[model samples]
Target: MTSDALRVAAVDLGTNSFHMVIIEECREKGIVEIDRVKDMICIGRGSISTKMLDEKAMQSGIVALRNFLVLASQHGVAREHVIAFATSAIREAKNQDEFIRRVKDETGLKVKVISGKEEAEFIYYGVRNAVKLGSSCDLIFDIGGGSVEFVIADSHGVKLLESRKIGVARMFERFVLNDPISEHEIKLLEQFFAAELVSAAEKAVELGVKRGIASSGTAENIARMIRSLQGVESDVSLNNSIFTRREFNRLYRMVLPLRSSERRRMTGLDEKRVDLIVPGLILFDTIFRTFGLEEIVLSDSALREGMVLHYLQQHYDAGQNSDAPDIRRESVYELGFRCNWNRDHSEHVAMLCLQFFDQLIALHGLEQRYRELLEYAALLHNIGTFVSISSHHKHSQYIIMNGDLRGFSPSEKEIIGHVARYHRKSPPSEKHVQYSQLKQRDRNAVDVLSGILRIANGLERGHRQNIRELRLACNPDMITIGLRSHHEPDIEIWAAELLKSWLEAVLHRTIVFEPLHDA
Candidate 1:
């Protein structure tokens, strides 16, 4: 393994199951998941309503934690590097301390029963990395066995976070009386969710949360269930799929008629979650309708992934100043590093792109928010070369659109991908499906940013860091770009000259470049 590879594991002692994931953190190569192990212990199946973990459930939890510890050890993850977190079920248990002590005594492992607020925070951490939370406000919810967490956040940070004891298991124990869930039972369930989520609903509406994303098994099951109803096979990953309110309503209608066993036979419904699916859907539908969300995005990452990200932020990140203003920038470069990119060249291009963006602020008339997208696109513009050099621009666009680059919204990600797509090859056109899907404003931002990116890329054609500084002189009809370099920068000037046409077209100006030397 390269020197950057650091092995770490996160064990989530969830109420429904125990999951542990071992990951390889290569300084340059984002997150490489090495191994994952999970067991259906159902520690909160019957005890959630009682506010305690039954003795059998406690034993199952202990056994699962022990087995998970062995798996982590087998993967060479030191005990100290393993982060084990326990959520709602344990947190609400009167004997939670006893369980924590018992686990320590039996397996020499400590379990942290996190508060509801912290659990919400971790869910946000995990989902933000998987889904682009963009600049627009988003309501992210995760359904666990004993609780459901709701967070209202954006690209900047979380605005509101709350976790409630409204998990499917808890609802199943209290309401789900009929096999086909009688109308009365469904109403009670809806009422409970409505009352419990009133604060979350109001906060979401107050924050203008038109977008919603659901994480953990509940959302995944809903996405899969919707796909199954469309007569599609259950092999696809629903992580990136957008589940709209209309589709959710359709699935809600279709699934409510089936009994638990019949529902289990449907593809994509987890066997373990069969009994709890009804309450889960009710909760999902309640939130969708209550908040008036346009669609609900599914995030496969949840508490487990959240724990891992928190560990990396606290440990692996270097050169990040306190308060972490550049967390997103650092994350973008980390992905480039993972792709085995030319760090020096990518950094140089990013620097030059930012220079152009700063210098031509008057001409672009774009806000500073677009600056981050430009920087990320420039840094990752060439990572598609990892797949192939020829047609790498297209490949780069695909990778960036798919890559889990942190600190960008879905719209911003699309803009970045388009910017990277047009960085070298074809310019942005209506024919490009992904580019065409963007809103008009985002499309304009992509064109302007992509135009600058192409010219900056040309200035670094040699990848030798030959160009030192670029200064632009603009007039009503002509824009003169002056390049300052140490040596006779002939190759750089020639490459830049060839690519000036695209910038000239976008800016609607006659473009000229000249080499200037210091006396």
Candidate 2:
């Protein structure tokens, strides 16, 4: 690989295993996956029900991640750029903190624990990039060891997202006690899954989603096993392929009578997943029947691919107007809409923030990266008002920290949250835990962006869009902001003056607000 080639790796610390893929992404060739590896750690095999990750599972996970790091280093991937995330098993485990600490201590890899909704969102991003669902709506499902994610979406955007704690490992540990699970157990499992999926299935039906897509290890194993049994030569590198309900039913029936030991000899089936296959098959069968789907397209691109695609979309050809792929300003605004925010006020504030950023770039000494974060902060600063008007800045920080804002790393998310949190009364300080936790550079970013956001928010204090444009005249001692508006803009100017102290302190210049036009 040349120096210019972008080599990145994504690690998914799943319940059943740890998966890592290295890819060299480029504009001309798109994403070229260089290598992929999976280790069957089964970290959730017996831990899901107990809510504890046993010592053996923790050690296995650490070893797996360490080995993955070695491979990534060998493939020329930068250590800091490697992305690693943990899913349901770790999220639900009581000893998760210990596991994370041990992994970091042994392997020097930071792991982000993501929520089920974020998991579903990432899955949607992966499928949207890999498979072409056209304009029609399609339901996508990913069954994991500790949970299952379902998403209803079209080519344009996702409509419905749901995730449940009804994964194969969890089901098998709870229901499958006998070899080739008993009919009573199967009946109980089916009832449980149907009850859990009732709301999502109804939503799918309401959306008129007839077609379906399935991803994750369980779906991939089933599709490959069925193909292998039908004398189809399995291609190791194949992904985003199609499989049918007929084929799934055939494999389900065939595996029903086989013991785990016998199933180990099956060509398509992964030996590690033999014990859990019965529950996996049962879960898929019930889902297919519930949704009235005859076929499902399979995407080998799961969450790991989703992370890589997000990274590429954010880094490649950034700021272009030609339909930025995933995680653009559109997605950020979509999140604001989901929170039922005041769109007019958020947009007006964001516009003013950007205008100020552009005009005083040299004074602030900030880059484009912080500018994007500022825009998001300005748009979502008032979202906490949905919770309560009093101390809404804190609420905004909480929301941004927890919300599913895609294409941002965990650190970046925290930075954005800090920026939004300081968009109001209190400025950044060493006493604020969130603000102080950031690195010095990030702390500086929060200070500068928050100062600008506060000024922008004040400029739109009336929420009437009275301030149409702003022109800044920068001098050594003071700066004059020329505001153009259709009204007197008294409230806007007063609010800005009140919040200009932080900006003035940071820039060492007094801010003076003046009206360019008065109607």
Candidate 3:
């Protein structure tokens, strides 16, 4: 019994259906679900043949949108607070522009067509907010109407985000034939799913992920089936339910031989989902077989919930300050400590690196996050020494790649790991997996910032607080680094020779390192 005040709404214009959720945010009672609406418009059904939405589909979609708009208006949701997004159906349709324009004209809702990656990210954010996951790594599988988005990440950040073109509705339309699907057609569907699952599993392996959890309609059905077969009460909650692989296989085998009517007659089968249930089972069975996952935890929340949580986190929670240690700085400091790196030397080098980063920010168009990453790389340039004194650069790469660094996204971690790898022995090259993952913009930032870190690390090689200051002068073709220190020139020369090659390769310019003496 909570007062319904301060409502927020999220609308999902999905490929198979239109869904809307209205939540009342209450401080004492937490989020109270006020209203929800769902309509199976099957927008993708129109685009499958013509690669554009058909007139009938457009009309159906309009009806659903109009209904959703009325619900939002009734709840007094503001235009700015109501977020709407469309998926594969809109993204793949040739007539998307007209459809979007018409929808906006009629319903006054602006729809954002998001990419698969963004979709996966939103889903992950949503699950993290709603589900209480144990310490084990989580792989979120979202099976929608036209596509399945898989995301693997821990509490740290997203490690893998990939999408495949297989969903319950799409699979049914493509392969599930016969009233109850025939054995021959079920086998065919299984083969097709098995192939796709193998490829996706291979990709997941490359990213070092093993566990998985289900996030959407198909998963909910599986949970429902489990509950019914166990003779659990219809009113039993799904919050603590779990489905084992063997049980899923049993359900799969049982459903594959049944006709659409037979499936409808089965317990816990929703009438609206009867046509798509066989293919959905096939998809799930294939995924479980391919990954060898023992069991899957079902999450009631998926994309819509994820979208709402993400919006709230970005707009509300992000503004509040917390006392947690800055993850970026902590990661950098830990890297140095693990390497047994000279603290005085690493800090001195980092100072010079930051100075260089600030000097060329305009030319590089680097963001503040990149600057933080650059500082991290500069501090940990010598992390490889802990493994072996020689070829420590390779060791540094291995450690950074494997170690869990909090507060860094997968992309940020890849950049920092690559930058650390390139500190001593090599320049950025496409041959390296981590380096190749960086976007063009980030690659350029890593290149310039890594150059600065290399030179700084070289300058502080004496390991005795010898280098007091560095004076940098940059010209069109060559940059000069002047080291002011009382240390022997031999120590400076040894470090400078290594710096020269790395600087030349990174900047494509000649570098001269010199030690200065007072007059």
Candidate 4:
């Protein structure tokens, strides 16, 4: 929403769903998600065998896009900025042109039907950013409703890119005949998949692979169901979360023989994907057995994320900023950029925070893990100012709570939010319901990390980045911190002296701030 930010929407018209992902390209900050909406219109339903668009499904698809444009407008995505791509189902359908024409006439959006190879490449671009997929050999594959695209590659670059017409929807229409799908059907489906994926499998073996990365709704559904069985919290992210062969086998066994009704009641199974999951299971199991992958990493990004990246690459020079090494850091940086944060001051505070965390480790007794949480919290401590400077700390906590930060587990994100929440105002208290919801260990993390952030923020008073170095000395009863600054340290010393009390209480020591004049 900044003056320089260009908000755009990418619409993926897949066989089973109509999804629109809206993002803003914020210069060096990279792509930040603005909003996304999806409608499971199943536009490709019955089109696999008929080789034409279904009238009802096409009508529903138009409605979905019409509504998507409204959402894009709400998010400030102009018509010219919206790009819609139809894959697999539409690409092969005879009436694809009619559907595209109706959509454009009604919604003012042009639909580009992309080929299978193009889809695979776009997916590669998408998953690479999310999963850090620059390995010596990383196999990226996405199983869509109508086709599954496979890409075999390594750090050097892509080795093989292919697509097959064995998607879950196609298999479901062709193979699924019974509720609780019989043993005979399972064997037949596996045989078919074995034949279809033979080439991709052979290449996967020839090239050798470090890991398999699965991106698509089917993969995410499976990961979630498995995690549900393992009792993972619902808020925890499935992005880059892994499941071993054993885990997949366990889920398959539970799902394979279940009736449609039974599967519908299952935990973590999306109601929309209940029927498709049967064939989905067979396809995924076949891929696993075919490729000899011990484990697969789940990516939240797929074609939708790829579309954003591809668009950014074409329009803006966006790709892999070394400054933000991982998705977690990049995601955090994007959120900070969206809020138009004072990067110099936030980075300075974060720098000071990490320094304090290392120097005070003995007193704090916190593990190295807390160091990351502290740093992210410091970087985002002022983002609430995006909403309004008034009680911006509260707004900051709210924003961080719902920012949907990728690559961070729910607990880690919660800890970061709580730390940022307490950066300015009162410390964590029992009366604050959100703070009280945390576990004992997490509450302690918030307390200590926020305490560090408070002093760091205080030292950077006036956003001057004056404090260059910190020297700490511990005594039996009191601790003294020496500050070295390029300018006079009167304000920083005065501000930190006031903010050090919360940290003193947390560390159970009296604290003193002294300005050091070094020759």
Candidate 5:
């Protein structure tokens, strides 16, 4: 926990499920997810059609919320900081006041029943950070139980936001009468969806939205099942994961006719979502067709993540400009900060690593993408010290491997961990189990990146940031690294001399370090 870090909990009381995400917000790091828990309480099960909360479902929601609050408290979130928002079901329920009063009286948690428009706005805030919205208009949507909120947005800001009443739970309760969903019901659903979606679809077309950002559990589950059908298995969240209309059509066709019992066994399809998935599949397929979307990218961050961001925006200036433009670098810096790293030394090493990487790119023969990895690895090379100073390099690797680093894929995270792990001690060898398991291409990247990191780390051995700047001269047989420092960097030079062998061996170049006193 960073000393000044504020831990907050955001709970989404949805129709089909209740989700709580514990987030730690740092002034510098933005929002980092600490832990999250979800319960399939199905709170809106009967409420969608009846417009009244079911007694049993209301009780289940209360219990789930109590548990969420307990977990939040265990994670050190203050009561005031634990914010819960009720969407769709509760908002539309006639007994909404009754449930809110009960929750407030029993658990002291004030459940704010937000409007569909507000929900869409919060969802926009959350997914915009998760996915790079770029400069073009993109349709962002969250399919809740009672309503599906939609937004048309770009890097500049949101241009349109609306919430429709065609949510999966609501549609399922109203239209789905068969296990496989009858053709008649399907036609009715299509007609109803078209009528309900005409305004949003027209707005999407008006905004020229060809790419859509899909959020919420419904989108994530669908994306996961689609990946599973394609034999792609990833433990990572579906956030920013892309699926083409062709791929989704393949899934929609394969899944739409399956019975509930058959659908339950589909890999990556949630057991709880077996029945709801039918309407969900139809809904997204309709969106693809109606909105003329080319592809949909998943954003696991939806209402819950949105709630937190909304809170932060209202109360603090922390996550405002920190998440969007260059999230990769921000995530790296946040991880290092959380580890209580020596910022000056780590930043100096990263600076030196970048300098070495840029000048020696020709020798390493690595693509420009690897340069970003090298810089992030250098920044977080010593974060294992957060666990212990002894064998901190190994700890650093473990941390990076499981650090919940944003804006990176699983393989990319592994590459970063391997680079940070090999920054010190022995160079990468066939004897290391993890290092050996990497693909040959990744292994080669690690070899070059870690080799560069080693010399860079050694250059700041004294941890004083004595070396102010660098100059690299590449010759056929030798690369001379020039250090500019106010005082003699004797220790740094000696350390670099000793540590130069790995990089030299990797690039097959002789290395030399010289001091430059002028500026």
Candidate 6:
């Protein structure tokens, strides 16, 4: 679609409600929110018990979707341009297939069920796009109908993403029994939330995250309430009227004792959200206490906004490169510097490893990312010798896994850790924790990269820079690795023998190491 003619719409099939936003994308004027709709279906209310969407709840959602489809069509939104996603409730429901089929039949819109990790990614995109919070580290919280997603990301990328079962609708249905919410019940809920918050907070700290951004209806409502109390226009920017922990706690305490009816009478609390206001407040307060956040800027956008941005970035702007640098390399380089490894030799080993990887890419089918990881593994393979000589590979694995790597995802870190672990030992196995944590694809990548690193490390064993050049020739039966060096064949032979076993185990075939006397 042309930039000016492009019209995009997003539907968030939330647990408590179905929400949609239609935006007209004008290149010169920027994006304009032209139409918005919300239908409170409470899909999570019935999903908790049967692990299946109740028939009545399914009908409620279908009706809402049909109405939305009509509205979208009226607004000139093409069926192909509209993106619809279902979150926690529908994703967890056992009979979601029937519900989705019915929705598709009635509304003509395909519903995409997103996992919690994907949900967190979209939320990050939304908050990052909507707000100009200058903080490098941000903790984003989205309290939805059935689940709460917490993400830690920065200009670099997502560091940690987690989702929990505590949400506004669930909290109210499971906890608040009294109209005003009795003090006894309040205490019990507070204790329960506190425990969860504490664990989440610890994990966030461990991941080196700071600052905070609140997203979704619950957080936005709190921001509106705070704004109304302060008598300010809600521009929804971080600078003007963000809430400090002290002020947030004061508001939480004030709202805690009020009845549901009384809460509706409050300036910022929406009438429909009265019953959930108490639980939402408790969630906010618990997070504040757990993280010890001084203040948090409220974001007007959440998962739906993020999803639209992601789709646009992926399809419309194909030239944009968002992948961060290789975190593993940075970590290894830093560790090597700290351990006082010979920089010349370390870099030489890494360069040779990458050279080997590039020459064998067609045969191995490994991606460019794996080559980068192998470079990193080679650089820090000898770092463990700083502590001791025996089983330095084990020490290196622990260090790489625990160290802070800026550009790597949790999955990438697992692969890097395994590659370093297997540099001088047997190939990665199920018994290895780091290897086990990785998905199958990543595990395979680690195995191939580790195999290459093992050979590179062996070739450099002389530590005197004896080997000059190497060539790799591969076939279905075996890999013929030829080394060109100026020195005697004794050192190269010993190293080649050590690498042969690892190469064979990884490729499940024989490996022949050949040494060339002269160029």
lDDT of each: 0.83, 0.83, 0.73, 0.87, 0.86, 0.75
Each candidate structure's count of clashing pairs: 4, 0, 3, 0, 0, 0
Arranged by TM-score, best first = 5, 4, 1, 2, 6, 3
- Better model by lDDT: candidate 2 vs candidate 4: 4
Q: Would you give me the overall lDDT of model 4?
A: 0.87
Q: Estimate the TM-score of every prediction.
A: 0.79, 0.61, 0.59, 0.81, 0.87, 0.59
Tens-place lDDT digits, model 1, residues 158-190: 899999989888889888878898999999999
| Per-residue lDDT of model 3, residues 272-336, tens digit only | 78887778888888787777788887665678877886776677763112222243465456556
Cα deviation at 206, candidate 5, in Å, is 5.8
lDDT of 5 by residue, 142-238 (tens): 8877889989988888888899988898999999888788899989998898888888888887788889888877888888888888788756666
- Top-TM-score structure, candidate number: 5
On residues 369-442, what C-alpha lDDT tens digit does candidate 6 reach at each position?
78877877777777777777799888777766655443354455567778888887678888866578678888
TM-score of 6: 0.59
Off-target runs (Cα >4 Å) in candidate 4 are: 1-3, 26-34, 55-77, 94-109, 131-138, 152-160, 194-212, 223-251, 286-297, 316-326, 358-372, 385-395, 422-448, 473-480, 498-512
lDDT of 6: 0.75
| lDDT (tens digit, per residue) of candidate 4 on 1-519 | 668888889999999999999987767667777788889988889999999999999999998899999999988988888999999999999988899999989888999999999999889777777775555787899999999999987645678999999999999999989998999999999999999988888888788876899999899889889988899764555776788999999999999989999999988888999999999989888888888889998888889878877776677767543222477778789889878899999999999999999998888899898999899999999999999999999888888878867767567778999999999879889999978989999898888999999999999987898999999999778889899999899998888877888989998899898889988
Model 1 lowest lDDT segment of ten:
318-327
lDDT-wise, the better of 4 and 6 is 4
As a whole number from 0 to 100, the lDDT of residue 329 in candidate 6 is 45
Model 5: residues with Cα > 4 Å off, grouped in runs: 1-5, 26-34, 70-76, 183-211, 226-238, 241-250, 288-296, 321-326, 361-368, 426-445, 505-508
- At residue 472, candidate 5 shows an lDDT of 90
